[model samples]
Target: MVKTPLFKSLPSRDRTAAKKLVAPAVIGIWIVILFPLLYALYVSFHDWILSQGKIGEVNFSNYITVLKDPLLLNAAKNTILLTVSVVVLEIAIGFGLALLLNNKRIRLRNLYLFILLVPMLMPPITVGLIWRLLLHPDLGIINYMLSLVGLPQPIWLADPVLAMITIIIVDVWHETSFIILVLLAGLTSLPDEMYEAAMIDGASAWQKFKFVTLPLMAPTILVATIIRMIAALKTYDLVYILTRGGPGISTETISYYIYKVFFVFLDMGKSSAMAFILLAIIILMTLILMRVMRTAEQ
Candidate 1:
């Protein structure tokens, strides 16, 4: 005898009831998320202006203009650099902290964990403001410490390269706590039998981490990396508050550039096109990462 499919096996009345239960959520999602996204896609194809309340001819010209813009190009480059730098540093530092905290002999581990999480708890804008004050050139504590150590004070948010570095450092400091929390949870959930077995087989610490811990932690690492990458790609608050995309627009990210185009330049069409492009890039990256993770799992 052939078996019935799961959905087919359900009673028609039950199926109808389930659909009724799910209808509100589906409708809400379409109204709140899908409708705006579809509207944005529509707006992206036109030459739109906010003050005049006019949407000019519908065409691909907006996309073409955005793609050819020098500011967009620069912002794209800076965004990629920032995302890569922050994600890598955060992973390394967070993993190290997690390993330290995972130690059975560590005292006051909870207190240390709480302290480490303080940065992540603060609002992004607040963190940016605090770091801005801390990194102030002449009167800031950072420069004062440098002076005390016989080091010349360099303008952090003024120079292009240093500005980028400063942003990256601030981002890492603020976001690394998330990675540490995720990795620590993953480490805690891992079974101990594998480590015991490795120890029985005379595996060294590094060998155990390499052969045992990493394999189990791969999914967690991928998840943390993806989360951090998405956040880094859309970084605007920190850049806005810390540097305002100044120092010759050296630290301007894609999101910040989009904001400038929409508000500062008041170019709605181009900004919408750029926003769609950014969304596409993010979706593509997320898909690639998910595929890689699935392949690793397999």
Candidate 2:
């Protein structure tokens, strides 16, 4: 028999094969994600006005301009309002609905869940377009119905205040399903023995949920909230398709403003800077949430 090696060479060969298998994905990520990010960061430091041919001029003046812009400030404020409102409403409404659906006694629960999830399944653009048609001030079925009922048919996306509220409602409608699905899965995965013990202890329905369920489910809720908040901070497509930051910019978000700066205003440098700023904000939120999650887990 041949002398056996102390460490197998096959393991090294396997590692090589595994690296070969993962190489494409790594390369693709570099090309698709890392390269663009690096290029964008480089661009942020230079003035690159497409229209005026002011390319490759290094400066941080645009970043200062962006920081001081009142419109950007307004967009930031609007984003905060929209993010907070939608997250709160969606979490409250979604968790409530999840609790209802999680109950075995609810009739046609599957059907209801399917219907409720329809909006979320639709693309954001499609949702925006559908709601636009439905909420059209003059020609929409909603306004027509309101007229029949002798009520004021407000312009959903035209009025400044209403535009913001409409965006929030539309966002809630589209996003609540996600919250419900996450929370419902969390509810389902919880151990039944704990609840059985609680029942043995003479805990009421509300008491069981408050004392046992909430503590166990807190982490899941925090995770879902963080994911939603990150997405919320990056809101652009809905605002784009729905309002285009119009009706006097009441619904303008930082993402939308950055788009306008890059594409509409032809200011690539400032847009890149704004994008990084937004990234920093997102990273901050993520870091804070991650810390909270770790603490909660412990």
Candidate 3:
């Protein structure tokens, strides 16, 4: 039995050179990504940075304090509300839009897609500013339109309930395009024969959709949900721009709360703890989503 010439010709020096070339790049990436996470973890267990600055002592007091803080609890509630509401709305709207556009009969599909995706592609700051202007009570376009229609103008950002609604609207508007793109990909990838067979069997539109479209698109939908959930959970830029976590903290999410703790309040220890806690929640949710998706796939 003769070994391959390629294997026989391979030299120890080549392997040594390849290792030396790759090692530094791998270490550089680890330092860039892992180092901040490690430092944040270390800081999360410390007491407030005292007069000694970097010489401060370490403890679990910060985590304990945050766990007991009423503000943190409220922030947690608001975060969950914002994430779930926006994600659900985005998925529904996105699915509807994807289904509509998937039909070849729809005229100017490219134009429709472009229009739908513009909001998602806009800069977060720009989106926030545009929404702020539109939602403004006194001199905004929305109010003006309402007045023209003999309706009372609603204070979109000033009331707590309205503020939450405004946040969800903005999130859904920006994120629905992503869902549409993902689902549309799935729709286009499906085998048309299944739908043809369903049609031949005299299946109703609803029945075909329920029995054929959904099962085939389940994996794509799961992936899109995960992506949207992660983005919604970490939503910060639009919230910061539109509300600044304002209207009496009604829109204050965990990310915004963490920002306030670290930057506005200058409490690094507790902020680090909160950040780690949020990280843990995100990890758990991602794992759950992955497991459910795998089950569905099988």
| Candidate of highest lDDT | 1
- For model 1, residues 1-298, the per-residue Cα lDDT tens digits are 7986677578889989999999999999999999998998898898877877788888788888889999999999999999999999999999999999999899999999999998998898999989889889877899999999999999888999999999999999999999999999999999999999999999999999999999999999999999999888899999999998979889999999999989988878888899998998899989999999999999
| Residue 58 shift from truth in candidate 1, angstroms | 1.8
Model 2 per-residue lDDT tens digits across residues 1-298: 7986765556978889989999999999999999999999888989898898857788868778888989889989998898889999999999999999989899999999888887877899999998999998888999999999999988788789999999999999899999999999999999999999999999999999899989998998998999999999999989999999989888899999999989998988999999998898889988998999998899
* Candidate 2 local lDDT, residue 277: 85
Clashing pairs in 1: none
Model 1 CA deviation exceeding 4 Å by range = 1-9
Residue 104 error, candidate 2, Å: 0.8
TM-score of each: 0.93, 0.93, 0.91
- Candidate 1, position 57, lDDT: 81
lDDT of 1: 0.93
TM-score for candidate 3, please give it: 0.91
- Show how many residue pairs clash in every candidate, following the order shown: 0, 0, 0
How would you order the candidates by lDDT, starting with the best? 1, 2, 3
Task: Name every residue pair that clashes in candidate 2.
Answer: none
Q: Which stretches of candidate 2 lie over 4 Å from their true place?
A: 1-10
lDDT of 3 by residue, 55-113 (tens): 25778677888889888888889988998898889889999999999999999998998
RMSD of each: 3.3, 4.5, 3.9
